[model samples]
Target: MFSGKLFLMFVATAMAQKDLSVDCGDDEWVTVRWRPELGFSQELDSSRALLGNCPPSRPASEDSLFFRVFLRDCGFIQQVTAGRVSYSNTLIYDPQPERAFISQPVQCVYDLSVGEEEPEETFSMEIMNPDFSGPAQSLRFRLGSSIPIRAVVEPRSRRPLRIYLESCEFATDANISRAAQVHPIIANAGCLMGSKAGNSSFLPRRRPDEMRLYLEAVWFAVGEQVFLHCVLEACAVQSLPVVRKACQFVPEHHRWVLLDDPSQSYACTCCDSSCLRTTDASVDGVSARKVLGPLVIVAEDPQGDASLDSQSSAGLSEAPVWLLVFAVVLVLMVCMSVLAVSYYLCFWRGGRLGYRPSRDLLTKY
Candidate 1:
């Protein structure tokens, strides 16, 4: 018997036929909950200070600490949020549920600071393609080929605020310490549009409110992790919390993101040789077919021997020896053929030497 608040809206956009009512799943919303006593308090803290931690450091500078926002495939995050939506979403109740609903996107914010007002926060999270996936999600990429890395950033600010796109794990700089220092990556606070789709007509940032990133993948990234970090350099909190010694009205609405783990990001694995994606199918569930990244596939041992991978490596090393032996045998055959030709032309055919074939069969030298 768990009950909380339910608020639904009707969203009609330029692309809508008339009016669209989204079935906001009772279980799907957004918040932070990992404890018993502090769970409620932490949720309140996150909701209250949604954009409060935007450090006052330079937006694209090396001094800023990237805030860690663990974003997974949209399906996974939506599923988890959906399940918890009905648990406890009743801070300020909405009076309208019978009215037409609107498309509700989870509020997104950037941690942008320009100076010493805010502390540097590491924003670590992975950007995996959407799919019905398990704990691990990885995109298969060839060694020399490239893959697109994109991220959708939606600001939680009420008004248009200046934010900066920082560094991603795919940065090419050899001396990069933070994820925001890469030059080729999108940066600055120019494409400032109200959190709406109709404001921009660009390809990457087609949705005005959302910005899509194109991170370049490198050959060395054959086996590594990828993460994206964005900072809200515009301002801290739209409604800064204070000592309400007297009275205060209900604050602005915001989404409390479930901070994700950096290690949970997809792990890249390079395939030097072609491998059959063999796995145990006896067990049930998604693990039967696919799994998270950092996947390991071992080659079958030859002759059904004990060693699997070690024997395969030893075989590669022994290839040169086999080649050397074949080369030596070929050289000996060529030398014997040359000797026979010379003997026939100079000794037997030219009348200098005579042939002895039957005598060799009867005698030993």
Candidate 2:
């Protein structure tokens, strides 16, 4: 009986050593819970155990019953292969007395479904009417007219995500490159470069996952087909990062203004020069490329010239018929009088010449 009791105790010890549990079901984070054995609680140092070399986000909670850590805060290493994204880390714990370490590998796998059939399609960019009632069917626009553009991330994909326009350019083709004739509209991570000379701007956002850009219709060449290519990024952070901004150049003020937060216009001062990029890789974000258009900007109607031509034609028709006839007859009479005077002079000169010829003949005889 005594030997049996000792064997049961040994089995219980082995089970307690394997009590580490990791849950990767969370969308944004993985939860790690560690329960210490009955008497080893005081001997185990939770601080010594780490997730991917990152420490616990906070002290042990729930009356210290378990050590809880999040994958996002702990900086889990990410890997992508074969259209799959995986986050992985290991929890290692060492009890001071035993001098032996306990190891547990934790990982979370996410399938990348960028296929068109996927229901959780996240990102889209579209041109809308200025009022945003529906998609804009009129690709033809007039110069100085406002073109409303919107970029959106679906609500089902992720939460607490914000969208931003990283860079945008106008090109003649859908395939954009530096070698092509492209006009940079928005650059430096969302600064509206087109706003400097035009009235382009980023409209106030109505939602966190959506961004609206009001680009003024201006082009390098009139009647040329132009396409807008832009890079859209989604950030999971609650607030806008320093590098990500929606800046508009206010021609009236001669300064750049931040559309995300007008009070923090200081962040937009670099728009005139250059905006720095953020080196923080821990920020969860993804980018997508989008192209819109074959938009044509037409010149405004030449009403002034058209009206002048119409008036000149109408004036001639409006003149009295009798007055026109009288003018024509007057011109004809002037021509007839001049022709008769020339005829009489020619006849008299010929007669004089004949008389001089006869006088010469008589003198010779």
Among these predicted structures, which one has the highest lDDT?
2
Candidate 2 lDDT tens digits, 1-365: 00010111111112234465555543444556665443534644557555543445466554232434433333344455565556555565544636555556566666554451222336898999768988997777777788899899874654477788877878777654211356778876778998897878887889878888788888555678888877677776455455567789887888888887877888888887756554354465655667888887667632445667877889877777999999999999999998777666567556332334468777898
Q: How does model 1 score by TM-score?
A: 0.25
How do all models score by TM-score?
A: 0.25, 0.50
Tens digits of per-residue lDDT, candidate 1, 1-365, equal 01222233321122132221112332222232111122232221222111111211112122111222222111111111323211111111111345221112233222212331222222222333432122224354433222333333333334332122321223322222222222222211112111111121112334322333322333333334333222321222222221000111111322111012112111101111211122122211100001123311122212234355557878856566779899999999999999998888777775455644667676875
Off by over 4 Å in 1: 1-147, 153-184, 190-211, 217-227, 232-335, 338-365
Clashes of 1: 34
lDDT (C-alpha, whole model) for all candidates = 0.26, 0.64
Worst lDDT 10-window in candidate 1: 283-292
lDDT score, residue 362, model 1? 68
Q: Flag regions of model 2 displaced more than 4 Å.
A: 1-81, 84-121, 301-365
